[model samples]
Target: MSADIKAWYLSKTVWGGVLAIIASIANIAGFGISGAEQAELADGITALLAAAGGIVAVAGRLVAHRKLK
Candidate 1:
């Protein structure tokens, strides 16, 4: 993978697959997630991950003794 490319964890496909497996498990437990609901969940999770990454980046810079070149 190139440095410019985002990680697989940030991908919609990866998140959607995770949601699918979760939905399947929920189905076995008699709970349900509709298609629209799954899409919404995936979108929300993706945004949340991006925000967390941003926070980590900012915190790392704040905590670093060496200044950016």
Candidate 2:
């Protein structure tokens, strides 16, 4: 109902994390990707996680420096 709640659900970072987790679980369950596309999938997952980490770090710094609301 609240804007913050809706905003969080629409967050790219949140979705990225969710997708990464799901992919990891699928891979662990023997449904892992292979062949020519595996490398592309791995690269995407890596970038997604890395972006989430970088964003969180930047947000934290901004909050600490009194720049973010």
Candidate 3:
């Protein structure tokens, strides 16, 4: 596969998936604070992180290809 494709996959697929899993575990385990509120907050945070990671990864790959060309 091309470097750009590889980079994109790593960012959007691997990192994003990893973050989601971690977040889910943290929420279930009650890593911080207390009550259902804390769990809901954690879920929100996790979703944001996953989204950001995906965006960054895809953008980075695109930039890399553009620069290399």
Candidate 4:
């Protein structure tokens, strides 16, 4: 695999984003998702994605800062 694809697979944040997208697709397609509990799961996944985004942003800034130093 290319370095780019390998880096993507190695990133926890990217994995979280991918999972979030998949979960949304499943919810949209109404595949085995029903009632409040399942809906709550979606909400949790969204929150998880938010957290992963924050982590990625902070890490990116750190890398940029170090590179520019």
- Best prediction by TM-score: 1
The C-alpha stretches of model 4 lying farther than 4 A from their native spots are: 1-33, 65-69
User: Mind giving the per-residue lDDT tens digits that candidate 4 earns over 1-69?
Assistant: 575564344455555566667667887888643445455655676667668877998889988846653
Instruction: Compute the lDDT of residue 32 as modeled in candidate 1.
Output: 97
Prediction RMSDs, each to the true structure: 1.7, 10.3, 8.3, 9.2
Error of 4 at 18 (Å): 12
Q: Which candidate model has the greater TM-score, 1 or 2?
A: 1
- Backbone clashes in model 3, listed as residue pairs: none
Residue 32 Cα positional deviation in candidate 3, in Å, after optimal superposition: 14
lDDT of candidate 1 over 17-50, digit per residue (tens):
9999999999999999997899899999999999
Backbone clashes in model 1: 0
Error of 4 at 17 (Å): 16
Assess every candidate by TM-score: 0.89, 0.44, 0.45, 0.46
Better of 2 and 4 by lDDT: 2
Cα deviation at 46, candidate 2, in Å, is 0.2
lDDT of each: 0.92, 0.64, 0.61, 0.63
Q: Write the per-residue lDDT of candidate 2 for residues 1-69, one digit (tens) a residue.
A: 575574454455565566667677888997864433544555566667667877998888977946545
Better of 1 and 4 by TM-score: 1
| True lDDT of residue 56, candidate 4 | 94
